[model samples]
Target: MHQTPSRARSASHARPLPWRGLALAVGAAAALILAGQARAQDSGEVTKSHGYNFFGELKYPADYAHFDYVNPDAPKGGEIALAAQGTFDSLNPYSRKGRAAVLSSTIYESLMDGNAPADEYGSMYCVLCESLEYDEGKTYVIFHMRDDVTFSDGTPLTAHDVVFTHNLFLEQGLPSYAIAVKKRITNAEALDDYTVRFDFADDISRRSLIDQVGSTPVFSQKWFEETGARLDEPRLETSPGSGPYTIEDFEVNRRIVYARNPDYWGKDLPVNIGRHNFDRIRVEYFADETAAFEAFKAGEYTFREEGNSRLWATSYDFPAAQRGYVVKEELPDGAPPSNSGFVFNLGREALKDKRVREALALAYNFEWTNESLQYGLFDQRNSFIQGTPLEATGAPSAEEKAFMETLPVEVPDEVMNGEVRMAHTSDSARLNDRRNLRTAMKLLDEAGWTVGADGKRRNANGELLTIEIPVNSSGAAVLESVIETFVQNMQLMGVDAKMEKVDPSQYTNRERDRDYDILFDAYRVFLGVGTGLRQVFGSAEAEFSLFNPAGLASPLVDAIIDKALETSTQADQDTSLRVLDRALRNEFFIVPAWYKANHWVAYWDMYSHPEEIAPYDLGYLDYWWYDAEKAEQLRAAGALR
Candidate 1:
């Protein structure tokens, strides 16, 4: 799932007076002039704040020392080696041309930093800017850039770079992003050497506009111009970034090393304290999960987030683990689980009908697969926003029904009067659930597909009911077993279903081109709703949006998302989201899969973290530190080289 970064901070009603010294009269005159200029910018009173949030007030004060989650005095040194499963040919993650290396974009920095705590939804604190200025109506926003900020190449990061980067993305970034941004922002201009302003469009909701602009990854204008690098193209050369890490070395399909910049401009910033602690981050690539796991056991990589249930349950008893050289831990995760599933390609003619889609979804036996193959480690996912307050549970309330009635599209009776729809259940002992297969067959027959003499279903046009599932090679070890069972069950229902295993590069291209009947991916669910929903579920970009694989374009879904965005209070937003969940469940576009509530992680025992991990993020790469003493102890014991 392409998770949308939430953008926000509480609006300040007024700007604070600047401190004065011996030149008090001069300072007073300057302050009055600034106030007069602010009044001329908008009809409502102008306000200046250090951050912005859409949902509620900011948690940290303007002059706060640092986030409570971080260890401000944590030491920073040593390397943390990790693993990647696929090959990467390009260093640019923003473009769609080639597979981008992991953590490629970490070299760049946004204008503001998003709040990491799970409780502070939609809050953002300033990073590049000293403060943000806007009016009560939020018609426009101005960022007061800090003069001390500089790119890795030591060039001053001025307002001109910010304006240039914004325009660069508008012209060359992904189509979905370009489309959404153009509609929300009217203009981005450099008002001065260290001040930038963005004017908002009057048509759309203004709540996410500040965040939309603030979260923009600012690139060095001078570097881009000097190197003549296009944001849309793939290349190995990287543009100078103002962030802490810089690419040190990389070999295609093998390894990429990122070194922390000793002269990082924001190293001493309050928001950055005790963060970006790794002096070096090394990523080793493997052909598949088996190889990756083997490498982890051999100490080729120091850390691994175990995603394979079988490995977590049965394969962690290697010599290093038994000897206490490795640590296998499950950390608490409070964020909503990812809505992963088998997504139907609605653009395909054979799968477009609602009945056909529903029939395909019923073929997967989640209970049997979870117990028989996955070691019963996951919970079957039912809602797009599963395990959250927004998840629709019982029958719709009177208010929810009334809200649905106002939508432009028709609401199904199941969503209006019945209980919330759930995933089909099956007997855990069987590979093929006869009950579900019978129902699937009946639904397909109703949808005009009949079983032929050859025992394969065919439509009126004599077209075979085919479902092709393309699996990425890197994930084949883990996903193929589950898909194999699903295909058998689907085949038993008279549908010609098969799995196509391909390498990472081919899988990336094929998914982008929508070249399969069914693909496994996730539907991103956000705590705070925003304009980003348009890219995921809106009808406008459904045809070509890379973020939306299902090609889901429904007037009802679009209407509910819009309603959620326009809501004023958190309560109203939750109601609208519940309505959305109900509507999406009724659509039956995705075959619900499974998820776990905690993070399964394994690492060498030389690392340490805060006593309490942040609720939202594991922060392994952010807050976790390398212990020199522990490393020496491990090496002396012949556990690490």
Candidate 2:
């Protein structure tokens, strides 16, 4: 089973913004400039190189030995156990049918690696490909595969495999991938045994398109041909992949272990030099986070990344911690805070009115939640791209205002005046101030939801204003407490708000079907606001897909996204993004939630990591390695029972 490489395409769009101010200066009339460059490709001045970066210059040149952040001499020969919640039935991660094993991606490698240092602004280095070719316009790209690249089973990888992977995704994978790829890729053809060419559509951003295609995992064409298996099927036993590790052992729905491939083809690739250090990586599954945490404390799992703030603050006082057997640390989470919140389904007639949405937002008491519930460990997230330059700050820039004016209604004056804030009660008041609820009541009344004798808000026709927030069963405990607090606040304003916990599968289905009143999910901000935007807030997605869970179908939003995608300069991109952020905020599509400033990680102190972690990611797979001597020392110190 040759697997597709893990790409940033899945998580990049969820978070949109350039971190290092690397938005390239494509010059005046950027599209025309790119077109001119495309025409110049006939002159043969275009450079074919080993790698390319998204931003300015590549940090590492063609002859670079290894990444600067890795420890080249680090030795790895021990196992590292990690905890995973819920169960997995299939090893095929590409399929939408069942949950895939946690280590499925380790067995696959992509053509180019986008796991560059976080500050690199989404650059990628060649992995399986020996070198790549592209013109200045990036209208097309050619990947020259390494001659020695082969699957774990010794089957050679070729251009046909890459072509087959792309075609396979188009034919049988998720509709989102198919639709997106079809829109951007004009043609993907195998030019030779080890050479493939990809012609891109001119309408999309060339840089984003190239990054996406380059990061796609190349699969073995021969294996699929021999097995006659569809790419979308949930297969328990997958074909061998061309990566660092192979599935060593597994138990269905219990655990899985991956062993490093001693004869791995690209073990010495510069991109992989200090990465994938674990000799064996084992993952154990539990029913929920509580069980997973218990397993971590019991030493069943070697590491845990704590997501529950309560557990982080209150737990860890056990014998392991008292005996200095466990280590707890807060690592900086350098990425911009996600715009997480309760999203309204605009498809519901009652939620369509802007005033209604605003009224519901006012009912949320974030300050109280942070102080009393989260122990002040979280900060409120205001912008979709909060903490980034693209976030709409004190006011829209002059360029942003100019772009906003093109729409029928630019943002409200309050948005232009200063930083947009959600309704908050002073912490000292402990949610004592009823002013926010009064304001909510006023807004609801103005929106035709009047309080009746029954103490429920109702419209003229006597339909009560009801909001049902359905949460996933796995997160029921954590979210239920938050929802209870919010529902109480909404009830004070005579709104019939309630919370319901459902199975993860049911919740996913309902979200996809748009069957709930409001949803709790975060939209990933796009790094390079390209075709990915269409899947998120685009009008077409609003109609056909679940990406736009809010059912937000606005011509204004569509235009703004298009403008952002077209802008090539940092200034232009920033302005268009600010305008888009302002517009989204003005709609109150998402009732803002809170985000923690750091990652809460706890381990048994038997692993070694690079001195500096990637600003955006923990880099567990890329840099961290098992420490055998440290493990033995811990055992001697009674850290391990």
Candidate 3:
């Protein structure tokens, strides 16, 4: 699933996008859909299934007890406290007006819930839906809603609310989503109080139609009308939802607590049996990581997901660790690494040239940064889909070249025949490598940015070649230091480069406004690419979509993405994705950075998890249970407050 975009190391509380891996399962209905009229005429009926998987077989059967990765008998009832960097003013996560609190979407539930395993790609089981009906042609889908579901306000959740929520998003949601949804779905009608149907548009690809409608977050229609809530406005008054958690209490910019609903409607459902174990999930806000780490050392929070390599390597020798009150470990992370780096804002005129972007990328030394500042704990990210089979490797195959030949935009020979692009390597012992500096200077000079008498680069118009990386005050100290070193290197190349530090609120607004020349942001990496790519790389949305931080709009990229989404087989998809990766790397929009293959986590000794964690997620907030006896021991030892 595509995670929400965020600054360096900032945790996003927003829910994952629903339509991530919703392609039709291999060999399940492929022939039925591919044969079209012939298959539909032979079998003139739709099938009702308890779950859906677009790419592979469902792991759990209809009558299965629970997921193998979860502890169905896990105990419940204790609080888990984590830290949030930066302040928030709004409780409404749907709007674009204000910064929403972390985990603000915990109170919301979608029509279907996804499986926990990364290997079980695109599998979704019914939650609010008892079963969904779709034909072999896949032109339409009918959701048979469960009658017993209720909102947190004790109101019935029906098909009408689903239709209402979809329509509301169409009118007031993010522009990219609204535009994409309108083109795919032709009509959404409530057939009855307990049944809803969505008809698809004939012009678009039907691969992700079922997933698009199924993942819509269902909200309380009555709550919206009665409370006069606007989905586009910043407001503290939240509409009621049907999820397992509710807003328990809050203090703006200080802390927010979400308590488990004792009377939640779907608590006992098979899909939810082993999840939502915490009685309370509290988030404490801090200005930066330094303060948050000190608070964690003092027992202010119970869990910490360490993102700073320096701290993870050198710190953790506090009294709590010596007393055996905290447990620190590195857990396996099988998911693809995030495509994070210094993204050049294409909206800026100075960065419109590819040569200039490549020059800037050459200036940042990832080798030195990884070894000197990050403790050699990370690997240089080379592709958008790094470490995955879909990642383009050596020279493209003959089939890949043949496929690129048909694209409207010309694929560069370097991309079609050459090895996959990799970040430039430098000496780990020095921040400024003379060879890379000379290359960057030559590239800049050739691009019309020549060094002036004052030893600063300027264009033919005499405008200084300035680059600014706006960062929030809450960014990790090690990361800030890395940026400072990069700025120093850029300065050595006769480019005017500096880090602009701002408060969290201003940083948020500036990022939204696309006010910086270069910004450090991470793009969500997808296991199986889908229509969600439109929001991230499509030319139509690149100008305004917040997800497209670099404002990258390229005709070649748009064409490659379209080709990738139109594939029907896994092999075809992989070929198209390899081509797409080649196309994006050729653009050089982001200067590649470093990523770790595991999750670094530390927590108080009072919590426990299942022996085996799912490959995709840690499930700390979902399945991990609290230990009452261990908590009492910690309290007795005066290790916790």
Superposing all C-alpha atoms, what RMSD in Å does each candidate have to the true structure? 7.7, 4.7, 3.4
List the pairs of residues colliding in candidate 1.
8-52, 8-53, 9-52, 9-53, 10-53
Between prediction 1 and prediction 3, the one with superior lDDT is 3
- Regions of candidate 2 where Cα sits further than 4 Å from its true position: 1-44, 54-56, 405-428, 431-433
- Give the per-residue lDDT of model 2 (tens digit) for 1-641: 00122211222111223232234232343322121111224565565666665433454567778877788877867887887656677888777666677767558777887455453554567888988878777789898888899899998988999899989889987776677778778899999988889998885665467667787777888888999987777788888899989999999878988899999998888888888798887888777778877888889978777777888889989888877778898888767676578999999999999888887887777888777877778888887777766777666677777776765545467655656554344443465347777777899999999999989999999999999998877663566788888788788889898988887667756876788998887775544455666677777757655456788887777878776766766567668777777777766788888888787888888888877766776766557888888899988987675
Q: Per-residue CA lDDT of candidate 3, range 108-171, in tens?
A: 7767774343335577778899888788667898999999999998999999999999899888
What ordering of candidates by TM-score runs from best to worst? 3, 1, 2
* Of candidates 3 and 2, the better by lDDT: 3
Native-to-model Cα distance after best TM-score fit, residue 399 in candidate 2, in Å: 2.5
Query: How many angstroms is residue 250 displaced in model 3 relative to the true structure, after the best TM-score fit?
Result: 0.2
* Cα-lDDT of candidate 3: 0.81
| Candidate 3: residue 505 lDDT (0-100) | 87
> How many angstroms is residue 472 displaced in model 1 relative to the true structure, after the best TM-score fit?
0.8
After TM-score superposition, the amount by which residue 436's alpha carbon in candidate 3 deviates from its true location, in angstroms, is 0.3
2 or 3: which has the higher TM-score? 3
In model 3, what are the clashing residue pairs, if there are any? 23-54, 24-54, 25-54
Alpha carbon lDDT of each predicted model: 0.80, 0.73, 0.81
Residue 492, model 1: Cα distance from true site in angstroms: 1.0
What TM-score do all the candidates reach, one by one?
0.93, 0.90, 0.95
